[model samples]
Target: MNQLPTAPPVATAQVPPHLVDSTSRYVESGLRGAANTVRAYAGDWKRFNAWCTLNHLSALPASVEALAGFLTELADAGKKVATIQRHAAAITKAHELAGHDSPTADKKIKVLLKGIAREKKTRIKQAAAFTLATFKRTIQSMDVTTPTGLRNRALLLLGFTGAFRRSELEALNLEDLAFDEEGLIISLGKSKTNQLGQAEEKAIFYSPDSAVCPIRSLQAWLRVLGRTEGPIFVSLRKNQQLTARRMTTKYINLITQQYLGSGYTAHSLRASFVTVSKLNGADDSKVMNQTKHKTSAMIRRYTRLDNVRQHNSAKELGL
Candidate 1:
């Protein structure tokens, strides 16, 4: 009787006890946020660790003075107040994960941050919203005859209509799309707000005009893709050949900049959705329904320009 040969057993490498514990805690902490957030926190922690090492200071149980010195160095290097604050938060989170008290919680650190905020007069830059006219112009400018063009057109339309964050857009897969007579439905497995992996759906209705319809654009792109699985948007080689990889969030920002010029980011599509919806007379709650904004305050911030002009008391006074 003939028998198949047995394969050799694979050997597993043993991790050090300290490394095992540290890795477990780091992973557990990372699981609490979205992937991008985890990456940002990891980078922030690495920078802090590097700083502590260079200055011969303790990082795991960092002192308030050391943390304050790090912030001071960041400010001296022209880091924004928001960037410094986020770094502080990352440091705090890292220490807590290691079972130590966060130095960022000290009164001195808080006061230092406040003083930095008061010292810096830099304004936070917001992405420019795409109005209806600008949206139409941008869409029309895309030549959908080529493969990349088709993909960009579809990406832009879906992003604007769905009001999806850059991460959400890049996370979309072919399985997430559902098409029907009404329009297209996108099933988001996870998002910034839904870190529990809860399923959520966003609808994009068909437009009367085929040229500006997101559904039509998506269909055209899919036809070019010729696949029923994998990511919806993919990386294109220099020759315009589609790769079997998902697009990065940075690419989304670049695409927006390509169409709308500089200062526009991937968030422009989402902000545009909220701004245009309000300008078209949609209420805050209605816009919030589409945007999935957690608070009315955020929705208000998006529509502030429209509100200031529409609800201006000056219009009521006989000027």
Candidate 2:
């Protein structure tokens, strides 16, 4: 709703001697997070500020009672636990920027959130992950002769094997890739998880099957691209002419849904990577190496083995 500036002029408000140091610390760490997170904070804070205005309450220096009530309202409005939690974080960021003590630290706010999470189930809907069989089948159905088709094939294959987020797929440039004997190496400067812009690389090995191979598909697309350096994926005109404009993250979602059926989201590419890898007996460490997740817990979370019969040790035990 609101796009608050990531950085603002320092608040020159008077503060007590005891709080001055803590206030400075908060200011230094104000609103630091991943790009998507920061944007969410800005929008959520704007919505909170609007709500406070309607209720004639001060948004800045929010009281514990006010913060609790706002959070409760979000829950009542059917917002998921994750959304409510993010909203609270946004409010905290707002307070930090203003150099005010965040009411979110209060026990009342914390307990209120706990109660809301319990009352409303905390399980948010994850994207539906497809089997590798389905992935290959979908890839086979595409007509890569067209420029648009080639682009989609490259993105989908690369995204799945590399375990790339939609944002990362959209951010890919020609220079971000390096080809060698083994396969292609994708260099990522920044990503949803790797927000610090650390130098991260994901190795994509050549697939024995050239039809659904990421490296081969990418190379084929590049040959048609005829450009030394530029955005890898771009919008194409009706006549199959590629434009300088880059493909939007939303387009990535549409392309996935277009090929993989309406049931799957763009994230299915990455989620399926984890699910299929784990299904194939890949350990958490190996999956983490590809996904770049800091913890094994996250890799487990991304795994979509809904059927209890599959990957279960129950059947292996002596009955």
Candidate 3:
């Protein structure tokens, strides 16, 4: 009888140790929160780890005293109170993930944070809103002849009208846009408020004037781009040719600053929307629909700087 042919040995695939380690870190980071939040927490944890390594201490189960000392050193180094607080929160999260009690809750750590806040007089510097006049001037300054100009004009107009955060603006894709008789509808896949990947829609109504209309600007940009899919905003080469890569939030800030001058950031678009809308008599709930703000408190905060004088009871009292 003929013997059966010997079976060929099957090859076993082997994954490198480093890749496994990296994948674990990626998964852990994903579990924590949004990509930006994960990046920030990772950075904070790295700093804490470095400090521990320099002082010959264990970072995994850092002692309360050690954490307190770290905060003290950060304060002494002139780190912002908010920065220190974020660092402490990162450390606490790490310990919790490792199945250890959070050292950040120690009385000493709390006391140190309180002292730093008191010393620093921690006040958040809000981004100044771009008034309608300033926004119009900036738009007029843009040269829509070139691809970069068209993209920038569209970005600024859409960002302002939609009240989008920098990340939201940058995250936009061609698929997110839908045009109707009224104007355009943008579907936000995820945002700071909708972290669970829920779908949210923002409508951009058409303007009778073509000069300052976001919908028209966006249409012009898409027509020039000549593509049906992919990132809405991308980097432009020195020759003004569009690149396939998507732009970052940092770039958005730089672009806004470039056109609007100093003291304005990417957030200024959102703030300007809130301020202008409130000044135009749009109430909190109405603004919330455009901004996707979960609470009236945040809406008030955005409009507070501009509306303080207008909304004050003192004005009604003729003081």
Candidate 4:
């Protein structure tokens, strides 16, 4: 009988050190992911590494079972489901890059997303829409005689009139503003955009007319404040010199909180602008274009039909 020959012993495989280093460098340089996204993933990976180290487990080249265990640990520690999902997402992305498939990726992501939705439903208090009347009240309540107060008022007007996000407002430089025959044009450098999620790199121009109330308020503010150059809004110290330093997102939040009390957030200003423009018969597509919103779904989040306009429409329709 022709019996099968004895099977040869398997040899241990070894990957070269230089090959590993080269592969890492290639990933660091040439990965198609955005820089910010990579940074976030790196941060997540570090946290995972730390957790695994504390528990005497290996974090590198994590397996589906290890990931599931980690998520279970997170759940036990009362960590938010969103946070767990983020960690899972980072691991999944890393594994995909390493040409490996993760069995838990879809399941973990789905569970986390469901948890996020449930949490959101529990916190369903949306921001109340801002109105022209409420805006005037807020401005009037401010003690604009003080330099800081005056600057804040101007900032508020700019934020509302230009539909500026906190980041966009903070990034504005004095050179970005242009005085032309049409009106005042403030150049916006960055804001949240659907096209890129956030931090869009292009500059957009926002025009505020002297004839309009919001624009007129801004013009009056610019005239009273005498701030035409340098960083448009500088931090005002007790000495009253406009510091070379720029304003921050936190300052925007504080200022809005101070003026509007609890329900009025800085983002409400931008939303109000979009809502008012839509109620005034401005085209949604044009408004979306100006706001740099790539989708109608997101534009709806920022734009709502004005209550007064809705009432008037109802009356006209005999409803």
lDDT of each: 0.82, 0.86, 0.83, 0.64
TM-scores for every predicted model: 0.87, 0.87, 0.86, 0.66
Give one digit per residue, the lDDT tens place, for model 2 in 124-196: 7799999888889989989988989998999999999999998888888989999999888889988877766
What are the clash counts of all predictions, listed in order?
0, 0, 0, 0
Between candidates 1 and 3, the TM-score winner: 1
Query: Where's the lowest-lDDT run of ten residues in candidate 3?
Result: 1-10
- The residue-level lDDT of candidate 4 at 50 comes to 78
Model 4 TM-score on a 0 to 1 scale: 0.66
Best by lDDT: 2
For model 4, name the residue pairs that clash. Answer: none
- How many backbone collisions does model 2 have? 0
Model 3 per-residue lDDT tens digits across residues 125-167: 6889877888998898788899999999999999999999999
Model 1 C-alpha lDDT per residue in residues 1-319, reported as the tens digit of each score: 0111112222224656557666664556453467777677778888888898899998878999899899999999999888888899888767655556889989999899988988997656567786789889889878887899999999999999999999999989999988888888888887888877766789899999888999999999999899999999999998989899899999988998998888688998999898788778788877777788789899978763644564456876986
What's every prediction's RMSD, in angstroms? 8.6, 4.4, 9.7, 10.4
